[model samples]
Target: MGEEQFKGVFVEEALEHLTLLENALMELEETPDNMELVDSAFRSMHTLKGSGAMFGFDVLSHFTHDIETVYDLVRSGSMKITQELIDLTFCAKDEILCMLRNDYDTIPEVQKKKDELTKEFKDLIERYRDGGNGATAKGTLKKPDGKSIPDEIIVKDIEAPRYTYRIRYRPCTSCFLRGTNPLLNIEELAGFGRASIVAHMDDIKFLDEYDPDACYAYWDIIVTTEKEIDAIKDVFAFEDESSEVKIEVIDVSGELDGGDQYKKLGEILLEKGDLTQDDLDSVLGLHKKLGELLVEKGVVNADIIEAALAEQVHIREEKKSQQTSVEETATIRVPADRLDTLVNLVGELVTVQAHLTQMAVKRIDYELLNVAEEVERLTCELRDNTMNIRMLPIGTTFDKFKRLVRDLSKELKKEIILATEGAQTELDKTVIEKLNDPLVHIIRNSIDHGVETPEQRKKVGKPPKGTITLSAIHSGSHVLIRVKDDGKGLDVEAIKNKAIERGLISANAELSDSEIFSFIFAPGFSTAKEVTSVSGRGVGMDVVKRGIESLRGSIGIESARGVGTTITVKLPLTLAIIDGLLVRAGAGSYVLPLTSVLECIAISKDEIDQNHGRELTMVRGQIIPYISLREHFFINSTEPVNQQIIICEVNARRVGVLVDQVIGEHQTVIKNLGGIYKNVETLSGATILGDGSVALILDVNRLVNLVEGVERDAVKRLGMASEMSVCE
Candidate 1:
């Protein structure tokens, strides 16, 4: 066929092979002794090399060959899989990706790196090759009986049913330059069975315009006789190393004479009864003189003509499928940019629908109002659909941690097991991508700092093997991701002393347990006695805090020394939009994430009390600290007759935010407040109200901290709070 068609096939198959390679490597790591995984890995590489050579990627094929050879040995049980071998395979996989992207200038350096890794692979293979005898040598397989064995094993003399060999050969563009003859390969196949060629002229250029150095023709040969597929494959063994070839068995026993030859476009159309001789003649006439024929003859309706054309197209596709080796399957590979574009379009549609709703409310036209209402309903559904497209199960990220924990535990000389729960919880793709690195850092820190050694754990009357648990769940409009470790928890006193020494807190400063523990996320803060490369470098925890914050999320730590530590991160379900509780704060309107707002109550003057010069309100049976927007934002107000208190929860702690009035629920479109307002503590983002006014989205976590900090300071001064006031 056309070069474009072949190129598409090559790219598709190459990507499939790459994915297979990655999956096989992952499986091989877990079950290194499973020969099936090794064999599958080898086949994927072999197919990739053959496909790459067909597509003019010579360097890729050459580099992959070496890796394939190593896997081949492993598949034959002559070599054993080891950690070093797996690492080398990962490097090889990376190189194959680079080669697929057509990067060749650095191939030499990459090959050098591969050579070094291959040397280690060779050493391991030799070690295993010497069997359990503990001798190291090359090019020999020694059994446990201490006897040298042959390099390769052969199985022969098996009988099976008679089969026909159908070989298809599509040479590479540079085949002629390599002094290869496709005709000679076809002739060599005669040794296996009776062979006849069906020359394909679909890819041939014009005789006068053809490039002499490029092979442009393909051949489909049918050999009807009793012979194994491998026997036929061996005939063209030399050419098969560099050519694109497919061999399959055809059962001619149930077909009519000349069936294969009749599988052409026009013949298939006739056989399928989609077109008659007269219809074909009429269409051909119209195609040749299109402008006149349409008006001159009333042969058929335009719809009928279109339908006939569609049928002809389908027929051609069916014929092409039968003639080619490619399988017929329904699948689509879309570029990532297209999905992003679709999401953006859906977002814009939602915004426009909001504007339309505004206009429809002002007009008195019933029909226009009805249309806008329907549009709003559709827009909501569309938004949800688009969001769902970007949602992926969190299990994909969790499965990778097993390998991480396995490798790290071995390195640390500790026994640790990672248990994941609710891994099927779904989150936006963007959130998952950003969460990977932070989660890895947290997991590493748990292994290095949180989990104690086996000896220490045994002394503490705990299990020798520490367990780190990762769980995710949906909470209202957010997803809660928790990393819990069964190890030594945070030491509040040590953290307090470090904060004082680092000038983070005053020496005489008094703080609660949670407040003291928060110091771990502060910049340049660490409590480790000695720094290891895995952790205690004082770099990642703060970064994790910043990353969670960047996603409009909050993180908190809960700990009990010698019990355990749990770090929970709360993130918005989707970043593009949110449901908010809009309220009037000072002269401006602010939106509080509806997910965090529990209830609102109007408080009379009698309920307002000044305790140690701090505003406090009794909600239900609990005394909750309150922060007034007027005082917090420097908004001067003369009277406070009937004040409203908005009770909100932050990480399971309740607090009240005093506002002028509660304005009802709003469907908010989150807009970034630029770099200047990024550091604003109490505001997460901004949105436009139905009245066309800009409203600030309140950060519940930050507000909780502010109000709680104020109340704690007041209680510390008065010395009247409970001993459990240390909120851990």
Candidate 2:
């Protein structure tokens, strides 16, 4: 294989191992005494090192060796896990990531970081080993069970009893071409204990028939080890179908005469598949040792019989580990664009079927109508199935925040705990991808601006560690995500003052609590007294709001002066399709995201005139503001005498939108608007109706804000009009 092909595969596997290492380190922090965690961490580093070396990342291999040694010490209980050690591990993890990203141009910087980390690790180990003693001493370290580790060596083969095993290893002629190095496997097996190798050359062809690239040699071996049978198999983890390895327990549990107990020459040859059982029996009868007779008969070579005191297929049938044995559901990785094309085709199918069903409804032929109805049902199911394939669990995104929270908390010298719930909630993969950045900003804002210092928290009788919770739940057709922080919350008066000072709000203007909090999202607006690296420069929350809205979602903020704050974001389950609340206003039919529409009510002409053109109306004793779509869109068509009120949640408030008629719910496939209509407000996108008409999707959030701006303008005009009347 080409270097590039193996490079990508090696990188992918290395990343997977690194993730495992990080997870193990995190768990070790919580349970410092868990030896399994230490072993897991060590194994991850070991695999990464081996794979890195095989893939020609020698720098990576060498650098990781030092880090791996630290974990080896940890696994042997010669070192301990401290905050400093875990911190260094995380730094090392980041460095390994950099290496994988091939920051080779910065090799000096990378080497410098590697040296610094290794020194820190050795220093930390020395600190624990010396126990602050001024004088150095060398002695065996005893375990908690009072067993002393031999002073002559470190951990390997320490406690477990050694058992000698005879082995045979044979490899495919083309194994090296596929990147399999049997020597590497043999070298690793040697790490277990003392190993003796005998090269068997019977498989070698004559000079004229020989191929340089073809492997013609096999091996018979003997090894004494304390490791498990599985550990021996692990040495050949990269073995493929063409390779053959057989291991037998000739001497286990202290069988002293292990050499004499090994399989005889004919039996060894039979075991390697070089001879049949009947051939072995016949050969055994001919000579005491088969070597001379086999060579005379030209049946085999001297080397083949010389290594008779072999050894994997015996252990091949050994039950695999639970982790490996479980049946793996087969899957194939296809390009994402192919799945998207499949969805698009399914979407077109739905559109066509909708047209067919509509035509069938108007026909009197029952048979044709039934077929159309069935086709519509199948199309809907297909659309749902196709869309479901794009859904992914949000937990993968949530898991990434642990590192973020850890790093930020350490950098700021604050103790913060990230609490997450409902991470199993799934959303369209595209929506989840876009949600990541906005969520990061929100969490950063929570940490930088919202959460109080540990000292501050304790003074207020709260826990020393502040907590930021991220939660998601399926609510109807939307996912309700909340980022809540238990910290000293927003000061309304301070926000109002800052808003007025920045010209975001007028002095002496009366505003609700929600309105005061909304000022934080105004561009270039901040209540922060000074800028910090994290978030104080006013570049965060406003962009967060805009990003959420871009996904056809909405953000709402709730805060208490001294208690805490919660920012709730409502996102559509999918961006590709929506259950739309279709409505008609003037000449155009519009699609409102069903998740945004709460209810539809009637408005009477008498009530409209009673209000005398005021845009506020009473609904069940509550005075809610309303917006007129005809005026907003600048439609020349006359308004309907009796209009319907679509009550929608805007900025977490009940706002009514007036439309000519309610066309009911629809399964609308969203299509983006062209560049020409990009700047238009109160219109998000468009969708195709059953009759092939284009219905614009309303931007409910923006529509409500527009009406509020108009209301403020009208109030100012009326006041000036009243003053002029009095002056006259």
Candidate 3:
């Protein structure tokens, strides 16, 4: 890869490391004694430091190194993982991300942050160092079993023993073409410790035949360093598969075979498998240099003799096993746009398949019909698989809320805990991404308004800490996400009075608790007694409503006095396609998402007339309100004698939709109605039919809301003279 591409890879990998650090830190704060989390954070930070420096992010690397020192101390039990340390590390992690985004301290704001964070980290290190006589100066050194260790028994910040290793590095001939500079690796090796490096020129070709792009020279080096064997391997990590790098321990703590004696040339060669016993015997008797004699006898090549002379260590077998495991679990990252393009193509194929099926059915060709059936089945399978690719577990987004809750609770001086369930419920990537803001609004409102302060909660016979439970679950083809809080619930009388004062509801208008709670989402509506930084501007719930509606989802609220509030948002699994019940109203066709449809019952103009023009109908002896599509959309046509009322559920309530005929279910690939129809809230999107007709997909929740809105407006206009009870 080119330098720019390599940098891109570095940025992606660095982001992964940052995520690891953030998640580990968050968990470490909860479980301070979890050594595994500490180790994980340490490894991620160390890798970030090393990789940043290698990728030319010097400032980032330096910043990471400072923070990594604290983790190192914690790892060695020299310092305790305190809340203050966790908070500081969180800030440092954010600074690291900012530095990375701004190109390693190029931006003034990020540079300033880096300076502040670096000073804090340094101060922390220094304070810990001076707090006690030794390791205990910073904090108590606790063992894994939670017992404090005495200072004398603890060894902290001690230098590791150094080992001397012989290294033979022969770069592949095409390494330079693959964008590797062998010199960089060689230079890195030099930094490990005191070293002797010798370049072999025996393989160099004649000047006329030499290729500048091909690597011919190899190196033999002996180095002693305090770093582990893995550190050496990391220097050549990128080239491990392509280059021949042999590293063998020659001495440990200045001991070679525990004495001054060293291995003979024949012994080194034989251990390296460069010379057989017979070949070794032949060379030993010759009294010539073992390597030269071996080459002269044609028993080994000159390069092999040279390599054996170096006799470096091979990577341990366990390391190879680890690499194998890593390779098995490796994944390829594909750009999201490509997946979107694939889904779009699949949608087009579905439309064409529907067209083909319609044509075959009309032609009365059994053979062609069978073929079309097969095509339809394949299309459905392909569509499902394509959608599944975009499905992501909701847990990724849930993790982010933990930090949100933690910081906000601190800022508000409240004791609150966020509990989540069904985080593994999967939704489309697009839906999940768009859902962040709406969920944030819901959660923030829950924390600020729905949840009570510690004292208030304690007075109410509750625990000092309040809880907000965010949960999601699959409801057929849709997912229901609910945010529930346990604290002071909605004050029904106050909400009703406010709705009246704001002209949102007639004073005498009797409405259900759900309806009153929904008034909180109105523009410029707030129940807060005073404004604060977190909320009370009257903007959050309004945006929440609009955002959820924009995603073709529905939002509802349920609350009881002093029992807390719950906000539920129901959303489709995907935006690209839906299973819809196709129906006709007057001359236009419409689709109701099949997941919402409960059943269909026949109704007629006579039945409506007999009921005195009322919109209410009886279903299984229970009264249900219904909307006539012809009257609602003003579609002018002669009414059918036998009309169908499709019973559908919206916001946990059943309503009937009156249409002329109920067509069978359709695999609908929804198409946007564009900006022109953006203001039309009832129709979510349009879809193509088998015979090339366009059927508008109805937003059932919005339709119900629209009807309720009309009824409220009517009551307001008539001074509450005549009441219409179509919705409850």
Candidate 4:
């Protein structure tokens, strides 16, 4: 692979390892005795370190090695996990993220922190690996049977660690000035196991042509190391600044100890990269030890032949391991922009199909109308299929919050458990991405403010270990996501007092429990007396509400003094298109989301006029507030004698929306109004109608808010008039 392509793959693979490593660590903290988690963590660290080294990220590799060493002890039952160790691991995880992002400015600070934490790991390894002096720690690193651990164990569970590499190192003419010693690197590689070298004198110039300062010497070094190719390459980290170093793994587990080997001469020659495959294939017909024959013909030097034979055995061993690895499931990673484009194209197709249907209906041709209906059917099917492709299970997004809960519980010194249900609930990928932050904020609030401390819970006769449940499930065409907490619920009177004190509501304001609970979403409204890093600063719920609402969703809260609090967010299945009820206020048609609509109630203009002050009327003995679309949009035309009120629920309260006429259901292809209608909160967006007219899509949540705003004003006016009458 090309360098850039390989780097992309490395980053993708490295991030996966990091995620698995973090999760395993979290699980390990809960069950420190679980060997499976220990092994998982060990494997992740091993892979990460090797990959980092392979990509020339020596800093990453070296730091991870210390962590790997500690986990090795943990896996072997030499070291027991402690709270101190888990804290250090969390710090290490953060440092690894900073390193992966390559934030140079932050890396220096993280590096210093890494050094401090890694030393603790090193000390633990030293104290447990032997029974000698400085044994202040309680854990033993030594094997219980008094058996010495092999050097191979320091790496991983491998049968053999003998990999031969033929190195060609030629330094820059002025490399000596860089203070990089090539011989030192060579010595380090030899320290692992075995080594041999043959200096290439062919490149050396004649004495008259050579310069004293510029070195002309280079070498072909043969070495076998008890490490991976990446580990050996790491030795040359500094050497690459001014040298050309080519190190290829010629063999992985060759039995080079025997003077007489079983490897054929042609195979060895081909592996050494000196001879091509065609040359070996030609000689394979002569099924004899070809090396002796080659020696007899004086084709290659004795030393060169010796190195190839040593490499030949290890190559075959490498092949055996390759054949044993299970095939990995392949996946393709596509850019998000491409998916967005596809969704947009499908949206256009929906619009065009609507236009075609309108054209066929206007023409009154049976065949054209039939074809149009068929086209519409196919279009709807296409839209559904395309949307399904974009739908992803919310479990992945939910899984991410485990770490958040873990670290926060630790920092706050509170015992908490996060349980999730309906994690497999699917939603549009776009909606899922937008939902993450809101979920995070809500979870943080649940952890910080909603959930009580262990001692506090016990005093209230509740379980000391608080529980926060995150759940998602489909409700018809929408999804209901609930973040429920088991702790001291919202103190209603306290919230009421806070709302009154904040001037959000009057003392005489009579509201339902849900309405009173929704006061928590007011901007900068919080009952929190103290501010911490978590959600107590009063800046969270408002943002969460706004985020969910921006996606055509609504959030509601239910709380009891001692029971608990559950914040439920209702969201559309997809943001692309929806089924809506089309209606007209004056000349303009508006579309109301079909999912929210209950039943329409027709009322005459006379009834609407008589009930002017309250903007409400009796619907089956229920006084439901209604929004007059004519007045809402400032329609200049007079209202028709017969009008309809669309009954819909928003924020847990059912309300009526007045319209001039009800024009049945519409298959809406929503389009952005962009800058033109961006400021109009009452109208969410515009959609193209069948007749090529633009229909404004009403924001039911905002429409309910408008009716509430009118009521607040009426109450203010009434209070003022009453005071004036008392003065009179």
Q: Summing lDDT over every window of 10 consecutive residues in candidate 4, give the lowest-scoring window.
A: 132-141
> Worst lDDT window (10 residues) for model 2?
314-323
Residues 1-728 of candidate 1 have per-residue lDDT tens digits of 79776767787788767767766777777788887677678778777777778877777777676676667566555667887788778777776766665455656887676667657656655556545333334433356786755423311214344455556677776788888888788777755555556565656689798897888877666665556678887766777465778776644332333343434334433443435667556656445543234325654334333333343343343345445633555447655578777877776676677777778788877888899899989988988988888888898788778768877987898898889999899998888989998898888988888999899999999999999999999987789999999999988888999988876666789888887878888778998888887877688898887788767788889999999899998988887777888888667898888877889989865556545545777777898877788777888755367778899876567788888888788778777799998678778788766556788888877766666667657765655345457653
Candidate 3 lDDT by residue in tens digits, 581-661: 999998899999898899999987899889987899999899999999989989888888999999998777899999999
lDDT of each: 0.73, 0.79, 0.83, 0.80
Off by more than 4 A, model 1? 1-30, 47-60, 90-112, 122-331, 362-368, 454-465, 499-516, 560-563, 604-613, 636-641, 705-728
Ranking by lDDT: 3, 4, 2, 1
**What TM-score goes with each of the models?**
0.63, 0.68, 0.71, 0.71
Per-prediction backbone clash count: 0, 5, 5, 6
Winning model by lDDT: 3
- Superposition error at 431 for model 2 (Å): 1.6
Which residue pairs in candidate 2 collide?
Answer: 167-311, 168-311, 245-312, 246-312, 247-312
| 2 or 4, greater by TM-score | 4
TM-score for predicted model 3 compared with the true structure: 0.71
lDDT of 4 by residue, 1-728 (tens): 69876767788888888888878878887898888788788788888888899987788888888888777777666677777777788788778777777574455677688788778878877877653422223322345565555434544655555677877777776766667676787678778666766554555678899876666667667776668888877888776556878887755564444233435666556655656676545555565566655555555555556656555554454444444552443457866778888888888888888888889888898899999989989998988998898899998888889999998997898999889999999999999999999999999998998888889999989989999999999999999999999878888888899999977788888988887888998889999888898866789898998899988999989887788899999999998889999999999999999999999989997887786566888988889878888887789997789999999988777888989999999888778889966888887888887677899999899878766777778877898899999999
**Model 3 alpha-carbon miss at residue 58, Å:** 3.4
**Per-residue CA lDDT of candidate 2, range 552-658, in tens?**
88898999867899999999889887888989998899988888788888997788889988877888999988888887888888777889999999877899988
